[model samples]
Target chain A: MHTRTLAELGDALAAGEMSSEELTRHFLTRIEALDPRLNAFITVTGEAALEAARAADRERAAGRAGPLTGLPIAHKDIFCTDGFRTSCGSRMLDNFISPYDATVVRRLKSAGMVMLGKTNMDEFAMGSSNETSFYGPVRNPWDLDKVPGGSSGGSAAAVAARLTPAATGTDTGGSIRQPAALTGTTGLKPTYGRVSRYGMIAFASSLDQAGTITASACDAALLLEAMAGHDPRDSTSVDAPVERYADGLDRSLEGFRVGVVEEFFDEGLYPASAAAIETALDVLRSLGASVKRVSLPNLALSVPAYYVVAPAECSSNLSRFDGIRFGYRAENPRDLADLYKRSRGEGFGAEVKRRIMTGTYVLSAGYYDAYYLKAQRVRQLIAEDFRAAFAEVDLIAGPTAPTPAFDIGAKTDDPVTMYLNDIYTIGVNLAGLPGVSVPCGFADDLPVGLQLIANHFEEGRLLNVAHMFQQETEWHLRMPGGEFA
Target chain B: MALTRRQVESIANLARLQINEDEIPAYVRNLSRIIDFVDQLEGAGTEHVHPMAHPLNMSQPLRADEVTESDDRARFQANAAAVEAGLYLVPKVIE
Candidate 1:
């Protein structure tokens, strides 16, 4: 019951073999027993979950069940949930019980999915490793010593450990994909504006996107169908038609053109991870995908460019957390200036503050053009590179992270090393393309992720490709202590 | 491109963040390295390249100017640190 995918769970519920309330209690029991070891959850709404499950069961009995009815899923704390404390894994928002539900939350609830609880994440969705989380790091379920990746680490870890069948995650530069890579989960970051950003805590407005982490791409398709669409509340939300995503799965990958980025296999990548992805590409080839090496000349510049653009946007977006209106406030401020400074200083974590300051400095009077403007131009070049490459190929494939998960403290000292982990995944966000990370093979007994990227609004095509690969390979089905270890 | 202690201090002030004195050196070091890192973009050949603000190159969409939302001022203010007579209270700005 715990290891079943969303489809299997849905079938079981539809067949009247088990009640949603019983299924929810099963997962709730597992979470209570296992989540303490992983630190994957911030708050577990057991009472609310049971209540939602009971309602779903009652509705199912009355013959009104949706595809997602009675399925329990966790949401990364970044999204606001009415009445639940949407901490966003930050001290500033520790006590913030949102008055409204994020569009994603509302949509999923309407689909009859039971909200298990809010999963932990990096503070303000900033770091590449979950260590920066105010709730503490989420350890990889495969190996407790290594990180699960971030800022969506908690969601990834939760999904991987079978604490939940699926979970919601947000990616700004590789938060969703990287964690999914390290934890051996299927993570997707849809094209920018594909998922409405309304009520999701802002990180980098342009790059940030809500996505899903599940046991497989099939589950991703099911959940994404319920979540994708436009909401007028988010100014940047694209007014586009939602795809019947699950309907497009089970398609064959015959004659698919897969492009391998020449730069992604450079000297910095881990050899074992490279080996894993190479074999996965061969599996794609057997599934009828023709492979060719492609180039994105500005690929190496993504980290630097993203650092500038993301931080600048975050600095602007995070300004709303000033102590007066809501969130944490410094105690006993001597004056207005001190209130502003001390409140911001105390509320934000080190990485958040560092990003804020970097953003502040770059957008400052003398440095704006050199840092911010040049970075934006380079971002344009990066997008152009993708544009030129996608002209010849249907999809791009690579290893999601340079390697599998790293030691918790390994890259904390130098921020650059941590920044480089997303070296492969960030370029997609810069260009606002859809990308996914599916479990391919193992490195050092840990799982590796094979990344698949497509042009903008090509989420359906990407999901179909992933589903085909998943059909040919059993990597996505390998669970902890099943075969690898 | 390395920032001095004073430069980081001033930037923190500009951002309205109260970074402590002991943390200044680390900020100077990391911020300098990051700034230096982005400096590589200086050499990229972006001649006549228009800086991209949106990924899809779509202009901000305009909607009909009409009231689409109802007033939820009291509900929204429930999380405020201090509130009075339908308003948020903050440190006094005017003398």
Candidate 2:
């Protein structure tokens, strides 16, 4: 039952082979038995999940059920789940019990999906690895000693371990895709504004977009269809119609133009990972897609540009947590200024503070033109590069990350080294394009991912291409060996 | 391009984060490395390029001026650290 995909589980529920309650229990039991080793979940709402699952069963019995009815899923801690602690993996928000649900949470619940609980993430979605999480790092299921790429590490790890069929994640810069690649799960980041961000804790308002981490591309499509749409409350949410992503999953790749990003195969990429990506591209070519070398010349500037832009936005967004409102507050304060400083200092993790300080420095009066605006201009250049490539090709393909999962403590010491892990994935967020990472093959016995990027609002095409690739390969079906497996 | 300890303190003050004396040196080193890393952007030929603030081309959507939500201050303030008579309490700002 745990091995079944989300679609198969939905079918089983429809055919009355298993109740939603039973399915929910199966996953809850797995989480309890397995998550102690993985630490994937920050909070597990077993009682609430069972209640939601029972209700879903009643709805199905009453003959009013959606395709997603009773499907079990988890949300990254960033999304505000009403009455639950939406911690966002930060001590600042650990005590926060949201009064309302994020639009993503509301929409998924409306689709009859049951929430298992919130998964851990890098504190305030700031780090490339899960080590910065307030609750401690999530271990990759494939190799327990290896780090799960993050800030959506918990979600990706949970899905990879089959604790949940799918989970919701947000991507500002590879938070979803990088972790998914490391854990060998399917991850998707929709075009910016494609999903509502209201009540989804803001990290970098301009770059942050909510997406999915799932076991397979089909599961990602199913969840994305339910999660995508406009919300009046999130002014940035695009008012476009949500695509029938799952319906488009069976589309053929014949005549599809796939652009292999030349810059992505630089010296920074591990040779073994490159080999896996090249093999995946060959599979695409055999599927009747034409592959060509493409260059996003300014792509190398993505890391520097993103560091400035993301932190600048986060510094402003996180200013709201100043102890006057909800979130952690100091026990005693001499004055208002002390309250602000001490509360924030005591609350945010080191990585988050570093980002906030970087943002404050860059956006400071004297440095604004040289850092903030200059990075934004370079961002435009990077976007223009993607625009030019898309003009000649239907899709852009590359490695999701430079390499597979590293040892848990390997890159945490050096902030710049940690930041560079996101080099390949950040450009998609900068341009606000939709991208997906599908498990391609293994390197050093660890999963490598082939990333696919599509033009804005072309998630249907993105998922379709991924699903087609998944059909021709068994990589996505391979699960981790060891205790969990 | 390494930042001095004084500069790090000023930046921390501006961000409203109080770093303990022991942590300041580490912040100085890390922040300086980050700044130097991003300094490569200085070579990019971004002349005449518009600074892209957002990826979408749409302007802010406007709505009619009307009250839409019911009062839920009590519910919302459930997580607040301190409150009195429907007011959020903070360290006194004025004497």
Error of 2 at A4 (Å): 1.1
Model 1, span A242-347: residue lDDT tens: 9999899877788889999999999988999999999999999999889999999999999999999999999899988889888999998988899999999999
lDDT tens per residue, model 2, B1-95: 89999999999998999899999989999999999999999999988999999998679999999999999999988889999999999888888
Angstrom error of the Cα, residue A319, model 1: value is: 0.9
Interface RMSD of 1: 0.9
Q: Give one digit per residue, the lDDT tens place, for model 2 in A47-114.
A: 99999999999999999999999999999999999999999999998899999999999999999999
Tell me each candidate's TM-score: 0.98, 0.99
Highest-lDDT candidate: 2
Interface RMSD of each: 0.9, 0.8
TM-score values for chain B across all models = 0.94, 0.95
Docking class of 2: high
